[model samples]
Target: MKLSFYLHKNGAKYAMLTSIGGCISILGYLIYILNPLQLILDKLLTFQPGSLIFKLWTQPPYEVLAKIYIFNVTNSEQFLAGKEKLNLTQTGPYVYQEIVHNSEAIFNENGTLTYKPIRELKFRPELSVEDPDKARIIGPNIPLLGISSYMKNEYGLFMNLGFSSVVNMVKSPSLTNLSVTEYLFGYEDPLVELASTYVPSWIDFTKFGILDRLMSIDNGNTITMHLSTNTTSKDDILYQYSVDIFNGSPGLKQWGYREDIPEENSPCNTVEGAFESGVFPRHLKENTTVRLYRKAFCRSTSMIYENTDYTSSGMKYYNYRIDQNFLSTSEENPENKCFCKNSKKCLPKGFGSLDPCYYGIPIAMSQPHYLNADPEIRKQVIGMNPDQEKHDTVMKLSPELGIPIYARLRMQINLNVSPDQIVTSSKPFQGMILPLFWVELGIYDMPSYLGILINIAAQIPTIEMVTSYILGMIGALMIATVGVCVIRGFNQNRSDVESENQGLESSPFLSIPVQPIIRSEFKLLR
Candidate 1:
């Protein structure tokens, strides 16, 4: 009885242990299936005000540099005299630090946030090749060239005659020598003042600075972005926080898209649902295409996956290059037909007209040194050397986090000069696409704190998965051990029962018959 009691007690103990083991196994599986860590990460990555990602996005704590190289005219006099082709020499990499942040933030109930972008540029002399104030470049007179080009397109013969007379009276040269700072920032020119005075409606500003106007912070433009609060799908997460609207509109009015035009019909003018280079979609694949919008570019540019790369710290990144056909004419790419604007024929396969956005100036944009441009466009100039390594626009993005680690955005600004027989001052620059300057805006290195966060974020999934797998294995072993113990206990109990049965059958007392034992006892009593 004691042995039976002991076995029963042990069986109850084993049953309790088996239940615990089963529970542990179930708990491990639940952990693996639920992936609570990833859910926490998603919450942290949301664009709420107090979230870590929102703080980083609001005020980026990294250095962004703008390296500018001006094409200085070497032989202005000889070129104007028709004695030689326009000779140009690449001058410098005038480095400037760009400070950017979002201001006047307004959170909306529709899962969107609106804010005005504030950008400021400060010159970094230590990083530049030379002082922009001292370096002089003989380049085309931007004001004169732009005004002349506009007049030729919009005005009649009588207006052109009057413009020519005024040009001759001011003795405006086709080219002027000015310091790099004046060319980039602002330069006092009599023609600019004259144009402002005469055509105040068209030429509202008396100053014309390429960089100053391009990087103007007080434009009163606000951007609205979608916040990812709805779904946890990988693609949806990647598409999170993309641009939704600009200046209260999703399509650019300057690009001639009607307000009612569907997004599918007008892809170029539609600025909605693009990344502003501050962030990208997560889990980028080889076939993933990214669209980036910049106020300076005046439109969204597409980037395609090129290859894989690694950061200095060995973090993996996907390399994306600007689409080769971004600036192609309609003949080459039918989708670009909208970029023609008011022109009957599109600008060559290389150039995209920026006149619509640049206050009616005939400014065109191309790859630096006319890379991937028509061969004839390069043949018209003397010193243009297109090198892909130095001029291509590329962005290196972290696949897991969808963040841009390193980026190089290169673009060349040129004057689309059309020779005017009516305006004699423009005769020297007839039919010339004059290269002005090129800029490479980039972020070379990430801040240490940001890097640490990225590292942690990148490893979280792997760590969580590994820990879950280990727990599952441990739980499986525990359940298996409990099963083995229960089987052994059952076998031992059966053996004990069989031994007891056998002993009862073999005992001398039990072997005697019950009736005979009773009869013997009665005779003894008598």
Candidate 2:
């Protein structure tokens, strides 16, 4: 009875332990199937539009650095000898300040999201040079009034000038005097009206096309956007943009493809997928190239105007091509009016041209000081010393989370100058793409919770296995203990029964009272 009671008590505990262990094992398997990216996406959607989380995840974290380049125009003779000389000015490291002019994130009726900015760029007064007098000039030092006028009027080189460069020779006011931040990125919102017309920069966002297409367009429909004049505001032109998206690729609803498609359909379209897959994720075979499209502010020119017509349009669509090796090459060009007609203009690895977008000036784009570009480009220019450590654009990311632990995007600006008989002032600068300035945008270290989340996600498998093993062991031990108790109880009961039987056989009630007394008693009875 004692053994039965003990077994009953332990048996209930064993059954409960078995059930708990089974539950834990099931949970362990589920942990293996956890999708961290999907979880992150779900959490991101919960934040308010203006919340810190929304801004951090949606907007770019660009810390601007203005690296001004100076050309050695003194050696006009060497440049005339088929050699180009350029140098970087030891100018103040101008840090840019930016504030969103309009921080409104509008949700459209079509289920798309749009954000507008008139001129979000501003110079932080506190971080900038305290003395306006001490602030360094941003553009070329040589007076180009005659040359600029000649290009503008005679060559029909009418185009807006980037704040970094002056279109006409008039000295621009001090950085403090210019109201640089008052303008809207787009004069009017593109999505406000569903019209298919082009919008200029003063009234519109110059680069909004990229953002719009990224979040608003349908898959089969090509993205179209107008180009903003970097400097000459004489004309407004729009161009067409294109990029192919395969089914199942990670893309927004704007792409109009089914979100439920299998990942094997090829290429990742979403922002997370792009970063994780290195911009183009598909059946990326060796040596194959992929084209990525984005809207950029390009300096416009008259030459491009003549070729493409007032379409000022080509600038709206500039693309960069990259191979599976992650190495990039320059886009193919029929002819770029902004580039030198005589030299090799093909963009090299790490170097892209804004020529298609801007014509009066030839702007070469690359990481700050030509980082990741062919060493020869830097070697030709005097002040262009590429530093692999600081200038290089590096992206170290978590493949699963599609978030970067460290990221840096650096772009250097260089202008090409060739002697043109049409403008005599350009005689000194012949066959040279002078380095003007470069900017850097960096992001490092994720939010604490995000970091913690990544860590927990990484350890989940181990946690599952360990917990399941421990519970399984406990359950097995409980069962073994129950078996041992049952066996011992059975043996004890058997021993007791055997002893009782032996005692019964010896009991006086079952035997004749006396074998010895039996003989005398039996004779008397007879």
Candidate 1 collision pairs: none
TM-score of 1: 0.87
lDDT per residue (tens digit) for residues 1-526 in model 1: 6456656777777677667767776776776788777778778777778887777777887789999999998988898889999999998899999887887888998888889878888999999999899988889898888888878877799988898898999898888888899999988888889978987986777877888878872355789888752475556654567888888888777777777657544778777778873876566677688888887777788989888877666677888999999998888888787888676447898898888888777888999999999889898879999999999999888887778888899999998886555687788887789899999999976888778767766777777778777877777777687678767767777888899999999999867779987999999999
Encode model 2's per-residue lDDT on 1-526: one tens digit a residue: 6557656767777667657656655554444466444455445533346654446534534332332222223344454454665334434344444322323445444322334432234444565433333433333421232223224333433331321144223342211111112111112322212112342431122232211221222122222111111133221111111111222223432222245764523232232112111112111222322233332422111101101111121111111222212224523332222232222445555555554333223445666666666676667666666776666544433332323444455556555443342333344444445565555544443456766544554444466567656655665665566567678877877787788899999998889666779788889999
Best by lDDT: 1
TM-score each candidate. 0.87, 0.54
